[model samples]
Target: IPKTPLWKRCVQYTDILGKRLLKKIRLQYLQDNLEQRRTARSSNLLSLCRPTISLDPIL
Candidate 1:
């Protein structure tokens, strides 16, 4: 059997770590958004978003 080079092994390890970190961050972000929405839902109607406000991301 052939052995993987040291650099290739490092690359594979980093790839796995990167994917795990990405998944963790995504889950955290989703939870945070859900929590924020729950709080927002309980706010007074008068304190809600105004039509003039925009949340669009800049290109």
Candidate 2:
């Protein structure tokens, strides 16, 4: 079989690399968003629970 030409191969390689890079960036973005939401939820839960915890000692 005849091998593909150099320019087409380069284009195909670059296209694959670009897609992989974009996927990596999107994954990182989602992870950061999830981390931020987790932190916020934990902080909110702590704030909500603290007063109840202090009240429990007096009860």
Candidate 3:
């Protein structure tokens, strides 16, 4: 079998690393959004008692 050249191997390694980094970033973003949603839900549950304002302030 022919061996991969050093430069080609390096390029492939960098590409794989770039893909992994991007996936990690995407996962982190998703996790942050999920946390934000959970927090908003908790606040909504709390506000259900008073019923003074809209549950969703943004609306």
- Candidate 3 off by > 4 Å: 1-17, 41-59
TM-score of 1: 0.41
- In the range 1-59, model 1's lDDT, one tens digit per residue, is 12543333344456565766656655766786778777784655433556576678999
Per-residue lDDT for 1-59 in model 2, tens only? 22533333344446566766656655766787778887884456555656554444564
The Cα RMSD in angstroms, rounded to one decimal, for candidate 1 relative to the true structure is 13.5
Work out the TM-score per prediction. 0.41, 0.41, 0.40
- Give the per-residue lDDT of model 3 (tens digit) for 1-59: 22543333344456465766656655766787778887884555545677576556685
Instruction: State candidate 3's TM-score.
Output: 0.40
Per-candidate Cα lDDT values, in order, are 0.58, 0.57, 0.58
Model 2, residue 59: C-alpha shift (Å) = 36
Regions more than 4 Å wrong, model 1: 1-17, 41-59
Residue-level lDDT for 37 in candidate 2: 82
